[model samples]
Target: MKRSGNPSARDTKEGLVGWVEAKRKPIGTRPLRIKNTSRRRRDMINRKSSLGVALAIYLAFCALPGIAAEPDVNSLPKERQQQWDKIKSGMEQEYNVCIEHCGGKSECEQKCRQAHESRLQREFLKLQTAEAVPAANDTDLVHWRKTSGTGEQE
Candidate 1:
């Protein structure tokens, strides 16, 4: 029985069956369930936990010991602290004298140079004794004398 605008009965049924078959095929088809919310939440939790663990380990290894072992110089024994201050003051005076000698008039330069050299020699001897080391070697002494502008040899 062929209809006017529609095809014959067998043709119409066959066309509908083809359309259903195409829909069943997987070509360009999406999944029934789209988003996996649980997996995404698990991944977020794992990332946060790993970051927290790494931060804790870093602080423990890199920061804790440095904070614990630092000594406050102000809390040193009184005698040691006083000796440190004396050494600091002497160093300051020696530096000023050296600067004046290296950049001043001839008479003032000579006086300052002598004072600076004497103080430096004293300090060198003190350090050598404290460290149980020999005084400056011949080459070192020669270099120092030349640098101090008190070289006796050419």
Candidate 2:
């Protein structure tokens, strides 16, 4: 029977059959039941267990020691500590100068920092070499000079 107003509102036999078909599950398919509260509890437990496992792994890795640890300045030998302090101080001074020169720009400061670090590394290497080599005598220099064909004699 068709009502006069909206076509969708009309209750025809075809519409009745369509509604019945929509409600019916396909052949061989079971109707979906509301998920059990126990199933929801299990899912929550799984999520919690996974989170715990992840946290355990993180802690285990972190506790393994010296990960991303920077060398302590105070632990360095006195001479090395002095050198480090000098370099660090020089970096700050250069950084300030560079900032002033470039109107406080980050790029200039970064360049200044890199230069300072490079100088520090070079000086550190020099110190290491000096530490490794015992004081050179005049005789060694004369011997080397003679062997190398240098005309100058000590």
Tens-place lDDT per residue, model 2, 47-147, is 78779989999999986554333346665668777877777687668767776887767787778766665666665556555432123565567566666
Q: List RMSD in Å for every model shown.
A: 21.2, 12.2
lDDT of 1 by residue, 1-154 (tens): 4545545333454454222324464643532333556866766776787799899998789965654342344744565456656775787787686676577677776677566555645654454344221246655665566666676543
Sum up the clashes in candidate 1: 0
Regions of candidate 1 where Cα sits further than 4 Å from its true position: 1-37, 68-70, 74-154
By summed lDDT, which 10 consecutive residues of candidate 2 come out lowest?
A: 127-136
Whole-model lDDT, model 1: 0.57
Number of the top-ranking candidate, with lDDT as the measure = 2
| lDDT, candidate 2, at 54 | 100
* Best of the candidates, TM-score: 2
Can you give the TM-score per candidate against the true fold?
Answer: 0.25, 0.33
